[model samples]
Target: MNHFKIFSTAAATTLLAPAAMAQGIDAKVNEAFATVTGPFVNFIFAPIPGTSFPWIVLWLVAAATIFSIYFGFVQFRFFGHAIRLVKGDYSDPNDAGEVSHFQALATALSGTVGLGNIAGVAVAVGIGGPGATFWMILAGLLGMASKFTECTLGVKFRNEYADGSVSGGPMYYISKGFTQLGLPGGKILAVLFAIFCILGSLGGGNMFQSNQAHAQIANIVGDYPGWITGIVFAAIVYAVIVGGIKSIANVTEKIVPFMGILYVGSALVILIVNYHLIGWAIGQVFAGAFTGLGVAGGMVGALIQGFRRAAFSNEAGVGSAAIAHSAVKTKEPITEGFVSLLEPLIDTVVICTMTALVIIISQQLIMEETSGHYLMNEAGTGIATVGGNTGVALTSAAFGSSISWFPYLLAVAVILFAFSTMISWSYYGLKAWTYLFGEGKTTELLFKIIFCVFVVIGAAASLGPVIDFSDAAIFAMAVVNIAALYPLMKLVKAELDSYSARLKSGEIRAFKH
Candidate 1:
C-alpha cells in the first residue's frame, strides 16, 4: 500500500508539472478553438426561423412525442417488465452479446447521468424557476419511447464477430434497417450519424465532464491549473476504456450504483431534513410551471427552459444510450428496449428531480414581492445564481446550506460522475470511429489515444465555442438517428410484440426460476 501510494503521488506530481509550465497556454488554446468552432456552433444551435426554439431541441421533442404516441406509451406499459428484465429475471446466459442487462443499463446510465443531472438541472430550475421541473419531468417521460425504439433496433441489427465482440449502435441500425426498408442513402445517413457521435463523445461526453470535474475540485481545493486534473482523469479513464465495452461495463456496474447512492442518498437526507418544506417546494414547482412565477416570458420561458434542459439531461432521444444498450446480453432485442426506457426515468425523473427539489427546498431561489419574479441571486440580478455562484457551484451552495460538509462529498461525486461519463463515452466514440474506419486493434487504439488527449484539452481550456459545437454535434446525432427511427420504428414494434407474446406463452421463461 505504501509503495502504491508513493507511485500514485509521483504520477500526480508529474502530471501537475506541465500545469505550472503551461500558465498562458489555456487562453491561447481557448481563443483558437473558439475561432474555429464558432460558425459550426451557431449553425447547429440556430433557432427555428422567427422562433427562439433551437431546431435540434424541437427535432428531439417531436421524435419523443411521436414515438410515445405510436408505441402506445410503451415506456409506461412495459415499465414493470423493464424492471424485471434489468433484474435478470428473463435473461439467458447463453445469449449472444457482450454484457448483462444490468451492466448495459449502468453503462448507458453512466453516460447521461453526469454533470447534466447536477449542474444542468440546477441551471434549468434557476432560470426557468421551480416550474421548469414539471416540464422537465414531462419531457423525460416522453423521451422514454425514443430510447425504447432506438435500443431495440440497436440490438436487432448489431453485428456479432467471430471473436465474440460486437459492433452496433445508430450506425449499424440506420444502415441495415434502411436497406431492409428499401431506402437509398442508408450508408450516407449512417456515416453522418457516426461522425456526429464521435464529435459529441469528445465535447459533451469527454471535455464537458472533465471541465466540470476540475471545477468542482478547484472549488474545494484552492485554485490550480485544470490541465493537471485533466491529465490524471484522462489516465484513469483510458485505463478503464482501453479494455473495451465489457471492461467498461464491469467498472460502470459498480461505480454507477455507488455514485447514485452517494448522490441520491445525500439528496434524500437533505429532503428528509427539510421535510417540512417538501409540500411547499412541490407547490412552487406546480405553480411555477404554469405561471412561470413571474419569470421572463412567463410560462413559455419555463416551458422552453424545462424542455430544453430535460432533452439535454436525460438524452433519451439523443440515441447515445442505444450505442451502449446494443452491447447487452439478450437474444430478444426488445428486452433491451424495455431496459433502455428506464434510463430517462432514472436520469431525469428521479435524479434531476431530486436536484431540483433540493434547490427549491433550500430557498436558494426567492420570489420578489413586487415583481413576483424569482430572484436569481441574493443581489436580485436575475442571473440564476446564489451569491454569484453558477452551475455546480450554485448546486453546491444549495446542498451545503442543508449539510455543511456536503460540498466535499459533492466534489467526490462530481469526479466519479465525470470519470464514468468519460469512460462510457470513450466506448461510444470508439464504436463510431471503428464504424467509419475499419475495426482493428491499431485503429481502435489510435482513437482511444485521441480521446484521452481531448480529456486533457477539455480540462485545461475553456473553449466555449468548441463545447457549444460539440453540444450541437450531439443533438445533430438525434436528427439523423430519430429520422432513421421514424422509418424503422415498425420493426421495433414487431419485435416487441413477438417478445411479449413469447413471454406470455412461456417460450421466454425466467431463467432465474
Candidate 2:
C-alpha cells in the first residue's frame, strides 16, 4: 500500500509537471508529434485517382484479397476447422508452449477487440455514413488471410528463450525469413521492424489504450485527476504482465469473453428494439458502401472509409496479433494460424457491425444532419473535436436515444475495453523491447516501469498526433511483414498442404505433444 501511494504520487507529479512547466506545453507536444507523424499519415493516405481509397490502404486490401484467393480463401474453407481448433478438440496439454489455443486467441482478441469496436465503429459511421460499415466488414473478411499468414510465420520462426520463454513477431520473421532466403539487408529490415514495433507498442498499444480508458473513467466518475487513473491502471497492468504470458492469457481469457458478451448483448437489445429499421439500415450500408455520400468523389470515398476503419479495427496485417498468437501451445503452427483468422472476423465483422447498426438505426430516427464536424450544445454533451462530426459521443447519443442507460453502459464498456487493450499491449511492447535490449529481470522491470509511467502521460496528455504516428507505425510494420510473407508464401502453402494431408489421412486424430 505504501509503495502504491508513492508510485501514485510520482505519477501525479510526472503527469502534472509538464502542464505546469509551460503555458504552451499542449501546443508543443502536438507540434512535436505532428512533425513526426504528419508526413507518414499523408503518405499512407495519398489518394489514388482511379479508386476512392488511399493508395496505401488500397494496396493493403488488394494484397490481403489476393492472398486469400491464392490460398483458396482458406478463411472460408476452414472456418469450421479453426473453430474446432479453438475449442481445444485438438489441444494437447503437453504442447511445447505457454498457453492454450483459446487463451492465445483471447489475448490477441483483447488487444484488437476494444475501443475499435465501440468508439471506432461510431467514428466510422459518423464520417463515412452507414456505408463505411459495409467496407469495414469486407476488409475484415479479407484480413483473415493476412492474420493467418503473419501468425503462421510467427510460429514458424519463433525463438524459445533459455528460461523456457518465447519471443516472436515481425522482427523474427523479417530477419529469419530473409536469412533463409539468402537475402542481404535482412538484419536491417529486422531492426527496422523492431523499431516500429516499439513505437507501435508505445503509441497504439499503450498510450492509446490509456487515453481512451481514462476518458471513459473520467466521464463516469467525474473529474478525478488523470494521473490517479493512470497510476491505478498501470499498477494493475504491471502486476498481470510481470508474470508473463501465462498470467496475461489467464486474465484476458476471462475479461475478453465477459466484456465482449456484455457489449454485444447490449447492442443486440438496441437492435431488437429498433428492429423495424433493420432493413433500412442494411440498405443504407450497401448504398453508402458503393455511392458514398457522393462527397468523397463517389466510390473512392466509400472505399477509403471502409478500408481505414477495417485496418484500424482488425489490425490484421499489422503483425501485432502475431506476438500474441506466437505464445500458443502447438507444434503445428498452422493450427494457431487458422485460429488467428477469427480475430478480424470477431473484432470487425461482428462487434464493429453491431456498433454500426445501433448508430445507423438511431440516426434514421433522429434525422440529424450527417456532416463530419463537431457540434457542441449547451448540454455539455456533444460530438468530440477530434472525430469531427462523427465521434464516439455521437454514437453514445444514438444509443442513449433507444436505451436510457446506454451512455453509462458504453462508458463502462469503453473503460473495460481500454484496460484490456493496455494489458495485452504491454506484452507486445515488452517482447519488442526484449528483442532490442537484452532480456534480463532488470531490463524487464525497467520497461515495465516506463510502460506504466507512459500510461499516466497518455491519460493526462492530449495524444492526437502521437496516436496518429503510432497508427502509422503499425501500418509500417504491416508493410515489412507482408513483404516478407510474399516471398515465404510457398513455405506457408507447404505447411498447409502437409497439415491437410495429415487430417485427410486420419493420421492426426488428435493433437500430440
Candidate 3:
C-alpha cells in the first residue's frame, strides 16, 4: 500500500508537470486578456450611485421581478406541486432522458448549492452586512420565476441526439426561440450563449470548485500540497463525471440533500443555542439594510447587491441550471419548471439565510459597534482582518463559536458542495462543448479530460482575478438567456396552461410513477 501510494503520487506529479509549466504561460495570457477586458467588465458591473448594487445585478433582478409579477408569482402558488415533483411523485424513469426527477434536481442543485452558498453568502454578508440577507431572500423569491421560465424552455426545446443523448440549455432556447419567432441572428446569439456557458462551466463551475476544495483541505489536513488535493479531487471527479449524466446524478442525489441538511441543521443548533440574540440579529439585518453607509449609496445599489447575491446563489436568470433540469424524465416541461422553483428556496432562502444568520449573530457578539458596524479585517487572511475579505472563514468562525468542531464540519460540507458542483458543471460544459465541437465519443472524452486537468490547476494556483472574470462570463450568459426568455414568455405560459388544463381534466392524475 505504501509503495502504491508513492507510485501514484509520482505518476500524478509527472502528468501534472506540464500543467504546472503551462500555468505560467496561461497566467501571462490571462494577464494580457485582463488588461484588455478588465476595464470593460468593471465599468459594466460598476455599482449604482448611492447603493452597493451593480448594474448587471440590477438588470437581472428587474427582468426577473417583472417576469415573476407578470406570471402571478407562480413560485408561491405552485410550490407544493414542485415539491411533489421533486419527491418523484411524477417521475418516469423509463421516459426519454438520462435521469430521474430527484436525480436531475440533485444534479442541478449540485451546481447551484455550492460554494456560492458557502463563500458567496459570506462575501455578501461581509460587505453588505446581515441586512443583505433580507434582500437576498427577497431576490431569491423572485428568482424562482426566472428559474421556472428558463428551465421550462430548457425542457421544451431540448434536442434528443441520434444516440439517445440530450442537448439543451439557453443556447438551444435562444436559437430555437428566435427561429420560432423568425428573428435574425437567433442562431448567432444561441452560439454565443453556448460559448459563454462552456467557458463559465470550465472556470467558475469546475476549476473554482476544485480550487476552493483544495484550499480547504490544505488548511485542515496539514500541508498535503494543492497538487495532492487536486489530483485526488480530479480523480474522483473524473471517475464520476466520465460516466456521463447518470453518474453525476447518482452522486449529487445522495450528496446534495445530506450535506444541505447537515449544514442547515448545524446552523439551526447554533441559532437555537443563541435564541436570546435572534431578535437583535434580525434588528441588525433590518437596521443595516435601511440606514448603513452601505445602503446610503442608494436603493438601487442595495437592490443590485441583494439581487447580485441572489442571482449568483440561485442562478435563476443565468440559465446554467436549465441544462441540468432539461435532463429530467418528464413529458411536461411545466412540471420541471415547477420543480426548478425550489432551487432558489433551497439555495438562497434556506441555506444562505442560515449562513447569514450565523455570521450576523456571531459578528454582533465579537464586534463592538452597535450601529454602522464594520469588520476591521480587510485582508481576510485570518479572523482578525475584518474589512470583509474573509468569506468562508467568517462562516466557519460563526459556526465554531458555538460548536467547537463545527468549523471542521463546515469545511467538509464545503468540500462536498464544491465537489458536487464541479461534477454537475462538467456535464453542462460537456453538453455545450459537444454542441459546438461535434458530439463524437472522442470529442466528449477530450473535453472531460481537459476539464479534469483544470480541476488540478484551479486547486493549485492563485486565480483571484481569473475567478472573477469567469463569474462575469457566467452572468454575461444570463444576459443573453434572459433576453431570449423575455421574448419567449408565451411559450412558458402555454406550457403552464397545458399542464394546468391536464391536471384539471384528470388527464394527469396524482403522480404515481
Candidate 4:
C-alpha cells in the first residue's frame, strides 16, 4: 500500500486498540508522526541567537506592531465603531453578502476560540511561566491592527459570485491586490498561503482540535479507545460538512454562544471565588513577564510563549479570520475590519487571560514556595503533574481544584468548542481546497471525505510532532501572509480613511426604523 493508505490503516488499528494500550498507541503514533514533523517544528520554532523567541513570533509581532502604528492604533480608535458595526449600525437590506456582520464575527470567533484557549494557554504557562500571560495580552492588543488590515483587504478584494456567494481571504487579496498595485510577488504569496492553509486546516484546525477534544472526553468518561471517540466525532463532522448542510452549521453557531458564555462565566467565578489571591496572581504574572527564571532566555522565554500562544489562539495575522469576516453583509470593507479587530481581544486578552489567572491563582505550577505564584525555579520547563499529563488535563485540574464538577462541564464545552471550530475550519479548508482544486460537487465531496477521515486520525493519535507540525503549518501561512500584508496594507488604510471621513460627516448614518 501507499504511505497514505498504510498510515491510515495503522491509525485505525491504533485507535481501535484496547483502552489500556490506547494511550500508548497514541504516543507511538505521535512519535512516528513526530519523527517526520520534527524538522519543520524546529525550523519554525527555532530560537534566535542568544534568545528564545522564534522568528515566526517575531514575524507576526512585527506585522501587528507596524500596522498598529500605521493605522494610529486603529484597534483602539475603531473599537467603539467595531461594536456598532457588529450591531448592524450601517447594515442595508439590499446588502450583497452571505452573512451579517454579527454572524461573521461569531463565525470567526468560533473558528479561533477553541483548543488554543483551553490547552494552548496551559502549555504556555506550564512552560513559560505566568509572565507569559502579560505578553499574550500585549500581543493580542497589537494583533487587532493586523486583523483590521487583512479582513478589510479580504472584503475589498473578494470575488462576489453570480449566486451571491463570496470567496474572500488572503488568497483573493494577495492575488488581486498585488495585481492592482503592479506588485511582482502577490500570486506567489497567495498560492503559498493557500497551500499552508490547507495543511493547517487539516492539522491545527482539524486534527489538533479533534485530538484535544478527544483527550478531554477521555478525561471525563472511563478511558475508551481514542479511535472510538475519533470515529464518532468524525461522522458528526462529516454529516455537517459533506452535504453543504446549513442547518447543522446554524445549530452549531447557536450552541457555541451558550457554551462560550458559560465557559467564560465559569472562569470569572473561579476568579471571583479566589479574590483573596487575585492580586498576588496578577503580581506573579507581571513579575514573571519581565524576569521569569528557568528556560533558555529568561525574559525572552516568557515573551515567546505568550506571543506564540496568543497568535495561535487569536490568529490575528494568519489571515484565517479574513475569510470568515469576508462573508459579512456590508458594502464597505472597512466595517468588517472594525468588527474583526475584536476577535483577538476576546480570544486572547479577555478569555485567555482568565484561564491564565485561574492557573496562576490555583498555584498549580508552584513546584516550591520560593517559586513564586506564577514563577518556577526553572523557566521553560513544565511542572510535575500528579496525573503525569499536560495540556487540557492540566487546565482541568486547575479548575477542578476550585470546582470539582467543572471538568464534566468543561468536557461538554470542549466538545462543543471542538465541533464549532471544526465546522468553521472545514469551511476555511474547503475554500482553500477549492481554490487549489477548483469548485465542483465531486471535488468538494472528495475534500470533505478526506477531512472526516483525518478527524478520526487526529483523535486517535497522540500529541507530539504531528500536532506540532500542524501548528507550524498554520504559522507558515503567516510567513507568506505578512509578506502580502506589507504591500496591501496601504489599500486598507485608504479605505479606513474614507470610511472615517464619511462617518464623521454623517454620510454613513445608521439605518432608521
Candidate 5:
C-alpha cells in the first residue's frame, strides 16, 4: 500500500508533466530507441520499393494463405462446429465448472479485439482508403486457418498441471512438436519464440493498450496530464495482473461482447441512416483495395495496410491466441481449435469492418497540404489538427458525430477493452517468462511488477518509436513461430485428418441437446 502511493505520486510528477515537456522527454527516448531498434524495425516493415507493401506483412499474408490452402479451408468446412464449440454444444457435462471453449475464446478475444478494431481500422482506412476494408476482411478470413492450426497444436502439446492449470503456446508446440518430428533444435526455436512473445506482450499487448487508452480518454476528457490517467490505470491493472490472478481477466471477457455490441450497434445505425452511401462506401473499399483510390502506393499499399492491421487486430499467425485457448478443459483438443476460429471473424470481419465503414461513410479525410498526411475528420463537422496521433481519435470523432455522446461511451469502453487486453496479455507474457525464467511466486511477481511499470510509461510517453518497436516486436514473434510451423504443419494436418475421420465415424461423443 505504501509502495502504491509512492508509485502513484511519482507517476504524476513524471507522466503528468506538460505535454510539450513530455514530448521533449519522449523525443529523446524515441531517438535512443531508434538508434538501437531502428534497423530491426526497418527490416521488419521495410516497404517494397515502388510499392508500400512491407516484407513482414507479406510474410503473415503468405502464411495465412498457405494454411488456408493446406487445411483445405477448414475455417469454412468446420464453421458450424466452431460455433457449436463456442456455444458449449459439444462440451462434456462431466467437465462442469472447468474452462469451456467460450471462456477460452473470450480470453483470446479480449487480447485481440481491443484497440486494433477501434483504432487500427481507422488508420487503415485513413491511409489506405476504404478499399483496405475489403482486404482486411479477406485477411481475417484466411487467417482463421492459421488460428486453427496453431491452437490445435497448443492443446495437443500442452503441459497440464495437476491443479487444472495449463501452459502452452508456440514455445511448447515448437519445442515438443519438433522433437516429436525427429527434428533437432526445437529448443532453440522455442526459446526464440518465448523471447519474442515476452517482448511482444510488453510492447504491443501492454504498452500499446495503455497508450491508446490514455489517448482516447484524453481526447474526450481534455488533454490533462497523462500521468493522472496513467497512475489510475496502472494501479487498477496492477492489482489484477500482479498476483497471477485469472478471474479479473475472465471478467474482462464479459466486457468485450457489450463493447462490441454497442460500438457495432452504433455503426450499424449510422450505416442504416446513410443507407444510400453504403454502396458507395463499399465500392470505395473495393476500388481502393485494387487501385489504391489514387493514393500513393496503389493496390499494394491498400493490401499492406489491410493485412498488417488485420494481423494486429486478430493475431492469427502470431500464435498468441494458442496460449489462451490451451486452457480450455475439453475432451477434444480440436474442439478448442475450432472455437478459436471465431476470434478473427468477430474481431476483424465483423467489428473492424464496421469501424472502417463508419470512417469511410463519414467521408472525412483531411490530407495535410505541407506534410502529405491525412488528418482527422469528424464526419465534416470538425477539423483535426496536424500532429502525431493514433487511429483512436479519428474513430471517436466519427462515432461522436453520429451519436453525440458516443465518445464518452467510447472512452469507457476503451478503458475496459484496454484493461481486459492487458490482463490476458500478462498471462501470455508470464508463460513466456516462466518458460525462460522458471515458474514460481517470486518470478511471476517480478515480471508482473515490471509489466505494470510499463503501463505507466506507455501512458505518459510519446509513442512514435514505441508503437513502431512494439509493432515490430509483435511481427517478430511471427518470424520464429512460422519457422516452427513449417516443419510441424504436417503433424497438424494429420491431427485434423484423424479428428475428422473419428467424428465422421461416430466414434466421438458430444453433448446432446
Candidate 6:
C-alpha cells in the first residue's frame, strides 16, 4: 500500500503537473514522437501511387486471399470443426502447452475485439457510408484464412521452456521456419518483427486502449485528470498480467464473453426496437456497397474504409493473434489454427457488423433527398457527424438516440473491452520481449512494468503521432509476417492435410464429453 501511494504520487506529479505545464509537455511529447516516427508511419500506411488505397491493406487482403485458396477455404470448410476443437472435443489433457484451446481462443479474441469494434465501425460507416459494412464482412471472411495460416505456424514453431511456459509468434516462426527453409535474413526478420511487436504492444495495445478507456470514463464522470484513470487501470492490469498467461486467459475468458454478450445484446435490442427500418437498412447496406450511396469515392471509398476497419478491428493477418493462440495446449498445431478462425468471424463478421447495422438502422447518416448525397460537412469529403462527434461518441449517440441509458452501459463495456485488450496484448509483447532479450523472470517482469507505466502515459497524453506510428507498427508486422507465411504455407497445408486425413479415417476422434 505504501509503495502504491508513492508510485501514484510520483506518476501524478509527472503526468498532471499544472495544466499549462502538462499541455506544453504533451505537445513536446507528440512533436518528438512525430519527428521520430512520422516518416516510418507514412511509409507503412502510404497509399499506392495515384490511388487512395493503402498498399498495406492490399498486402493483407492479398495474403488472406492466397491462403484461402491454397488451404481450400479452410475457414469456411472446417468452421464447425473449429468450434468443436474449441469445445475440447479433440483436446487431450496431456498436450504440451500452457492454456486450453478455449482459453487460447479467448485470449486471442480479447486482443482483437476491443475499441475497433465500437469506435472503429462508426468511423468506417461515417466515412465509407453503409456500403463499407458489406466489404468489411467480406474482408473479415477472407481474413479468417490469414488467421488460420499464421496461428498454425505459431503453434508449430513455438519454443517450450523448461518451466512449462511457452513463447511463440511471428518472430519465432519467421526465424525458425525461414531457417528450416534454408533462407537468408531469417534472424534479421525475426529481430525486426520483435521490435515492431514491442512497439505495437506499447502504443496500440497499451496506450491507445487506455487513452480511449480514460476518454470514456471522463465522458461519464464529468472530468478529471486522465492520469487518475490511467493509474487505476495500470494497477488492475498489473495485478492480472503479473500472474502471466494463465491469469490473463482466466480474466479474458470471463471478460470477453460477458462484454461480448452485453455489447451485442444491446445492439440487438436496438435493432429489434427499430424492426421497421431493418429492411430499409439492409437495402441501404447492399445498395450503398455498390453505389457508395453518395459517399465520396463512391463504391471504392466504401470498399477501402470497410476493408481497412475490418483489418484493424479483427487484426487477422497482423500476427498479434498468433502470439495469443500459440499458447494453446494442442499437439496438432492445426487445431489452434482451426479454432482461430472464429476470431475474425466473431470480432468482424458478428460484432463489427452488428455495430454497423445498428448505426445504419438508427438512420445516423442523414441524406439529402434532392441531392441524393449524405449531408456532408463544410468540406463535403465525408458524411457529416452529429455535433462534431465521431468514433465512440458517434456510436454512443446512435445508441442513446434509442435507449437513453445505453450510452452509459456502452461506456462500461468500452472500459471492459479496453481492459481485456490491454491484458491480452501484454502477454503478446512479453513473448516478443523474451524472444529478443531471452526469457527469465526478471526479463518478463521488466516488460510488464514498462507496459503498466505506458498505460498511465497513454491515458494522460494525446500522443496522436505515437498512436499512429504504433498502428503502422502493427501493419508492419503483417508485412513481415505475411511475407514469411507465403513460403511457410506449404508446411501449414501439409499439417492441415495430415490432420484432415486422420480425422476422416477416425484416427483422430473427439473425446466423449
lDDT of each: 0.81, 0.76, 0.74, 0.78, 0.75, 0.84
Q: Which has the greatest lDDT?
A: 6
Local error of candidate 6 at residue 14 (angstroms): 23
Give candidate 2 misplaced runs (Cα > 4 Å): 1-23, 49-52, 293-296, 368-389, 511-513
| Residue 160 displacement (Å), model 1 | 0.2
Residue pairs in steric clash, candidate 4? 294-378, 294-379, 295-379
Instruction: lDDT winner between 1 and 5, please give it.
Output: 1
Q: Is candidate 5 or 6 superior in TM-score?
A: 6
Which number leads on TM-score?
Answer: 6
Model 2, global lDDT: 0.76
lDDT of 2 by residue, 20-118 (tens): 322367558777867866787667555678654556676678778978988999999999999999999899886777888999999999888876676
Total clashing pairs for each candidate: 1, 3, 14, 3, 2, 0
Local accuracy of candidate 5 as per-residue lDDT tens digits, 118-195: 767777776777777899999999999889889988888888776666788899999999888889999998898888
TM-score ranking of the models: 6, 1, 2, 4, 3, 5
What's the TM-score of every candidate structure? 0.91, 0.89, 0.88, 0.88, 0.88, 0.93
Model 6, residue 65: C-alpha shift (Å): 0.7
The positional error of residue 49 in candidate 3, measured at the CA in angstroms, is: 6.7
Clashes of 1: 1
Give the poorly placed runs of model 5, Cα more than 4 Å off: 1-25, 93-98, 242-245, 364-390
Looking at model 4, residue 62 earns an lDDT score of: 89
Model 1 lowest lDDT segment of ten? 1-10
lDDT of 6 by residue, 1-513 (tens): 000000111222322223442467777886787788779887887889998888988998889999999999999899999989988888888888999999999999888887778778888899898899999999999999999999999999999978888889999999999999998988899899889989888977888788778777877886788889899999999999999999999998899899889999999999998887788777878888898877889999999999888877888888999998999998899999999999999999999899998887654433332344433444545555667777777888778878889889988987888898899889989999999899899999999999999999988887666777777788898898888889999999899999999999999989885
* Candidate 5 displacement at residue 383 in angstroms: 15
Report how far off residue 366 is in candidate 5 (Å): 12
